[model samples]
Target: MKFFIRTFGCQMNLNESEIMAGLLINDGFEWTENPDEADIIIINSCSVREKAENKMYGAIGGYGKLKEKNKNLIIGIGGCSAEKERDALLDRFKKIDFVFGTRNVIDISNLVKRAMKGERFADFSDKLNEVNYSIPKRPFSKHHAWITIIYGCNKYCTYCIVPYTRGFEKSRPIDDIINEVEEYNKNGFKEITFLGQNVDSYGKDFGDKKPKLDLLIQKSAQFDSIKRIWFMTSYPSDITDSLIDTIAKEKKAAKYIHLPVQSGSNRILKSMNRRYTKEQFIDLVYKIQKEIPEVTISSDIITGFPSETEKDFEETVDLIKKCRFERINIAEYSPREGTVAHKYFEDNVPKHIKNKRLQYIMNLQKKINLEENEKYLGKTLSIIQEGKAGKNNTYMGRTINNKLIIFQSQEKLNGSFLKVKVNKVSPGPLYGEIIEIINNI
Candidate 1:
């Protein structure tokens, strides 16, 4: 049998899809790039935003057309959306044969087997399970991979659907994560980004045991082959001095931080169940900047929250100006079903207002990005080559601080590090001239 996995959403979902691919391949199924040619199809869905859900619907219709021609085709939906919308998905996509939640993803082979027997199955258990590290992964990039250090979220951010879909935070054992990174490093996947909805919350679920993110990262640095280590979506309240110290001490840990401040209004933040205030977030950013002079900061911001007034929106704008974030993911507040915001607040903000606010945020951020990046002009930076850009002789890479750099180079530099002297800087990638091939294999 042949299978095709269509994945959407965050790195976690993508990693899950890779795991499924490995599992399916182990069971004697070959992977097909063409969805129409596959005997089985899985849509690893996301429910983070209404936009993501809409895209999934559109994709399902597209795949449904192919299912008509191949009557033997087995279609399945997994990940966040399927975890939340299990049985309901069958009514929506009549062709969908099976539904499994995030936790049961490792048992996907059994689910496929049951579906092949003409039995429809839906599995959404609340119990947390340790992932089988023995499964081989067909990672999209051999040079870099997203490894989940922890699964799910403990923060019940009023607007977030993550806690409901992915359940509470369950951390993978620190040694397990370290061993995984070491194996990947040995296999020549040099860069690893440890993933979690909130990385700072790692090891908190370990009662009476010390939290392990800093320790795990420190140990990961011991592997000489691993070039870069990264973690994501750090809750501002949870970031610690130890983490900052580790980043300073370890050459492998990327000197960048992504701290999400959902809203700048103190009132909106309180309503959103976000622990930090606007002042506190500013202080945190300042603290990080003071500690790590070379660090680049990115953030997540939501505009047009239910309680946001013109004054509130302006405060958010002011915060953006103050922070001057290198980059930001700006989203218009959308009420998610099963979230506290959806239950308690009226969706009083008009669609037009939400969009306008989103535009305002993006416009301000674009200016900030350009201005901040311009400072790197004429400076030398060490970047890990990601891949070659489609543009002639242009190779794309990123600085250790996660700044994108595009430069002219002849040799294939992917999976290697090089020094570049920045000649031109923009809000996007900095154009540069290669000064040296720092390390090439």
Candidate 2:
């Protein structure tokens, strides 16, 4: 059988899709790049934003036309959106043959088998504290992979659908995570990003007396083959001094930190159920910079929320100016179903105003990014050659700070690190020429 999986949403969703693909391969299935050639089509979805859900519906509708040509093709929907409305989605999506939730993803093979036998299978969000087990052995690139450290969230941020759809926080046993990393390292994977809904809150569910994130990072660093360690989606409230200390101290840990400050306005933050204040977020940023000078800070910003006043918007603008984030993912607020923000706040922010606010944020960020890139001029930085950039012979790679660097090179140098001296800078990327090969190890 042939299968094609389309993934949406955050890194966690991507990791789940990888696991699902691995499971399918083990079940005597081949992966097809084209959806039309597949016996099974799975839409791994996301519901964090209404836009994501709309995209899924559109994709499903398009796939429905394909099903018309091949009636035997099995359609499956999994991940956050599927978990949010399982049986209802199955009923609405009559052509969908199988539906599985986030918790039951590892059961893809069993579900496919049952669906093949004419059974309409659906499993939504798992009950709280439930555990599903399967060790999926999926094929991966020899250079990089992702290892999930934890699942779900307890934060219940007002704007997020994760808590309702994915349930509360659950940390994978430390040994399990370490073993996975070891296996990847042994297989020649050079980089691993620890994934979670809220990575900083990892050990809280296990009743560990101390923070487990530090121990997990420290343990992963011990693997000699692991060249770079990175993790994401850190909640400010859960970030600790020890975690910063570890990242600063560990040689293997990537010098890039993505700590999301959803909003800078205290009122908007409280309304969004983000426990920390603007000052606290700034303090954390300062601490990370002080302790880890090479650390590149990235953030997420919501431009307009319900009832956001001019002052509130200005506060967010000021925060951006103050923080000077290395990269900013700016989004206009879109109220999601089952989220606290949707229930309590009116979605009254005018579309034009919200967009203008977003543009303002982006414009400021662009200026900051240009200024930061200027510092790299005449400096030699190590980069892993990702391959030719765009359609030209310009090779593309990234610095350890996760900054994108593009340079012209006649030689093919993919999957190896090169030392490049920056000769020029663009608004979006650094332009450099390779001076020498750094390390083949």
Candidate No. with top TM-score: 1
Tell me the deviation in Å of residue 236 in model 1.
0.8
Q: Tens digits of per-residue lDDT for model 1 on 407-440? A: 8886566777789999998878898988988764
lDDT of 1 at 75: 89
Report lDDT (CA) for all predictions.
Answer: 0.86, 0.84
The 10-residue segment with the lowest total lDDT in model 2: 125-134
Q: Which stretches of candidate 2 lie over 4 Å from their true place?
A: 125-134, 409-412
Candidate 2 similarity to native, TM-score: 0.95
* C-alpha lDDT (0 to 100) for residue 275 of candidate 1: 90
lDDT of 2 at 248: 88
- Lowest lDDT 10-mer window, candidate 1? 125-134
TM-score of candidate 1 relative to the true fold: 0.96
Model 2 residue 164 lDDT? Answer: 86
